[model samples]
Target: MTRMSSFRMSAWGWLAFALVPLIPLPSVAEGAAAAPVLQGETCSVPGLMDQIRRGLASKSPAYQRYLRALLREAAVTLPGAELQAAFERETDPVMAEHLAAALVARSEREADREAMQVVAKRALEDRDPAVRSATVRAMRRTGALEKTGDLYERLMRDASPEVRMEAATNLVEDNKFVYAGQHGPATDTAVAAAAASSDPKATAKILGTLNTEKLGAEAAGTLQGLLRSDSAEVRRSAALALGGVPAEQMGTAREALVSLYRGERDTGVRKALVQGIAQLGFASAVPELQRLKGIDPGMAPEIDAWIRALETGLQEWELILREKQRLQQAP
Candidate 1:
């Protein structure tokens, strides 16, 4: 027998998976022959909803969870319009939250305009943080690409750290998905739109991907603005991202990176700034890298590696002389 070792859920199925270990599922009558498992059957949405309603009315957490598990299973097979309607009419905010996620995850209508519109409304208007959190997933799953970018930029400043982090992560991850498709322009557009909001995650994603020099006079000006952003994460991300831009694309980025190193307040961000400057592989950065090594002996190894790498890139003749000397000495 093949054993189940792990599972992945793209949507809301985990709700059931979490509870199934604790509660015993309903058993078939012992005297009656067990009904044959049908291969092509789907759960009846209305019938299951009746049971779910009853379970909720029962006011037992266990029973509600049992019903929730059942709903999660049925959500896979439920009609999209019907699921949307169920969500619209659901009275309990928690169940409504789950239903919205399921609606976006299942059926062909996940991308329906009306579906995304309602989910966006709930994400904005709902006072419950949990409901708002779930709606972010629903919004990402159901909303159009441009709209999703816009929503994510707004949510990046959300009061709830969890929601803010989720928005930030999704902004980059969703951009990455466009990259996976090899839709290069789409990725650039998505990141550029959100990056303009000055959110750290989106800014990093955009900076790593765009030829910022092509943004007319914004050129290195955009990067300079980013380094001065109020958010340390944004500044840190900008420093790291600037390292990724090919030097030919913006030679000035190396200067920007090195300039930030001395004044950067956060030790971790300073290290990232050093890493960015190191990645640029400019020999001029060696002096500062050396200064950092002297200031913090703990940074010796990384600093030394950067120094060696920069020396090799900038002074290949030095390596050739050392090699030639070594060969003569070998005799």
Candidate 2:
């Protein structure tokens, strides 16, 4: 019986040993295999171009978007000929626009003046309004419009309001050739059209450009008219722009802003008025700023701060003017 029991135990042990391979065991270092890493030739320019070509040929919209992103990333690093070739081969207007945008982006990033001029000229002829608008912006960024003045004038008259606005903005900010004696009717007309656009954003952009270019006196009449606009945003932008008006035009700008402030109900417009007043250092406005600070609870702290700053600024300005007068009379 003892021998039989021992034999039975040995048989059971053998069966357990045989089943060990069939049962799943906890993963061990030596038993696990590492996943293979993917290797591709995406690092080289030619390889990227190949990818772009393939992506453009694909029917998937997602692939096209990916290609656009890749092109943007490559920018001026890609050969100009390659980009132009791609643009030429592209049949879809939208795809062509994307390719054009990539070229423009490259031009802007590298400050490639020649490339920008070429793209601008081509973009102006493009059937796509978006492409034309983008090219106008690129011209503005690269200051290429300064050289291509006719393009600016032509773009200002574009059928699309968006394109016209872009052209107007570029003309105002980038047209360095339109100097003191040469400010022509074309520029005046473009500015007027931009300021008169139904799109307040476009109008606001023009006003802001006027301020940035320090051409306030040139647009004094437009600024005055804009201050009376029903759109509070237009009025606010006009108020801020008043700060940049030429010294000869400050009085007119100040009067318009103060008059608008008196009847203005919007807190935002009122704040803009304070800023303009502060910019002008109009000491006489202290009383009105104080009054507004008392009544407008939403921006009381801001108004109060402006009041203090204006007071200090006006005092300093007065002292400088008095000293200058005293020195001039010392002869």
Q: What TM-score would each prediction reach against the true structure?
A: 0.57, 0.51
At residue 44, candidate 2 shows an lDDT of 35
Q: Clash number for every model?
A: 0, 0
lDDT per residue as tens, model 1, 269-293:
7767776776555677678688777
> What tens digits encode model 2's per-residue C-alpha lDDT throughout 1-331?
7974565456444433432334334456645765443332323344554556655778998867656655555655567777766765655555555666667666666734456566667657878787677656544533354445556545655678878777766655643334431443433444565565666666666555453334435666777788888888788777876765667877777788777777789988887787777667556667867776655577676666655555554455445345434543554
Pairs that collide in candidate 1 are none
The lowest-lDDT stretch of 10 consecutive residues in candidate 1 is: 1-10
Error of 1 at 15 (Å): 16
Error of 2 at 254 (Å): 0.1
lDDT at position 142, candidate 2: 38
lDDT score for candidate 1 against the true structure: 0.57
